[model samples]
Target: MITVVLPTRDSAARLVHVLPLLVPAAVDGLVKAVVFADAGSTDATLAIAEDSGARVVQAAGDAGARLSAGCAAARSAWILALGEDLVLPDAWRTPVEAHLAGGGGKPAFIAAPGPLGLAGRPLAVLASGEAVTAAGGFKAGGDPLKALLGRLRPRAVRLRI
Candidate 1:
């Protein structure tokens, strides 16, 4: 049972694009839920998530504190903290899951790199290990989706093969 706890703050556009990629609400009896934390979004972020059947939580004050609130609400043993601006391509999810399941007692945190720009605009980064410290860094171009997709669709980087 993998519960995906997604945190969002005034992320209407990003969430709008990401909500659809999530699949198999309860695959083989494992429940995969997307928990969205809305920290006083003046926009329609809450509305969009609610419409998508996502559990929305509107926390009050401070971005990091709000994210902490979201974490407290997560119901999965392995909650993948995803940014709103991320989406795992159709082909990558299964393989990524397998990779995690077979981590072989290594560091569970596996990153696949991500393009700096959109799916295809000429920007890339290939690295490993975690970049987040104790503090929150939701807007530091540190999105897991980029890393996940980078490996999922490496050709999109277009480094001229």
Candidate 2:
């Protein structure tokens, strides 16, 4: 099971694309929860997140700080930090389920495809709660995901999505 952490700021439009992808996984019991780390959104971001059954965490700092707060609030043993705009393919759950069933500890990544369905860059972090917490729960400045990746240096799983 995994808790997804999404950092948001007036991201209702983006969430509309990504949240639906997770619903099936949630129903299948693969997604334990979704946590929205909001940075004072004045739009329907909060409402949408709440309506989707995502726990809203009001964080007032940068993305890293908000991510840290979200990670802290996660209740699962695994954490999946996803960018709000990343729309996962329908088959995402299979590889992720395999990763978790393989005794998840090291970090794994899912790359977002480029235009024309070309291979793209890694876009998210999926790892155990301990690994994330040990990495200091994301830095307070700069690219937090990159910072965490640099610290963890996990073997690339290259989850094909």
Candidate 3:
């Protein structure tokens, strides 16, 4: 099982598009929980997250700190750290399940679609709980997620979307 961590800042609109896509995975037991790492959103983000049964944690600092806070609260052995707006493809489970079943050591990132692929932007980060903890939870400044990805030397989990 995996715990999804979404870092939010007035991301209510985006979550609307993202959350529904995870329902099948959650129902099928692939996703055990969802943690919302919010950076003090002034919108209905928290309310919606709470209504949708997501645990909301007030996260301060940068993106890395917020993600750390979310991952720290996760209950599953695998962590799926995602951007709020990056809606995953329907076939995402294939690669994710493959990664988990193969014994996740190094982390993996899902390649985004269109021109903003894996090289152009930060996308979904899939890693084992041990891998995340070993990285000391993401750095505070700069591109912490990217730094963590590079440090782990993650394999690419290509999605067919």
Ranking by lDDT: 2, 3, 1
Q: Highest lDDT: give the candidate number.
A: 2
Candidate 1 lDDT trough over 10 residues, lowest sum: 122-131
Backbone-clash count (model 2): 0
Candidate 1, 1-161: lDDT as tens digits:
45555556678777656555565534443435667766677788878777777787776644344444555676655445554444434444554456446543222232334476323421212111232221222222344334433443422222221
Q: Model 1: residues >4 Å from true position, as ranges?
A: 24-31, 61-63, 87-90, 104-161
Better of 1 and 2 by lDDT: 2
Clashing pairs in 2: none
Candidate number of the best TM-score: 2
Assess candidate 3 and give its TM-score to the true structure: 0.86
CA RMSD of each candidate after superposition:
7.8, 2.4, 2.5
Model 2 spans with C-alpha error above 4 angstroms: 84-87, 114-120
Q: Each model's C-alpha lDDT? A: 0.47, 0.81, 0.78
| Native-referenced Cα lDDT, model 1 | 0.47
- Sorted by TM-score, highest first, which candidate order results? 2, 3, 1
- The 10 consecutive residues of candidate 2 with the worst lDDT sum are 82-91
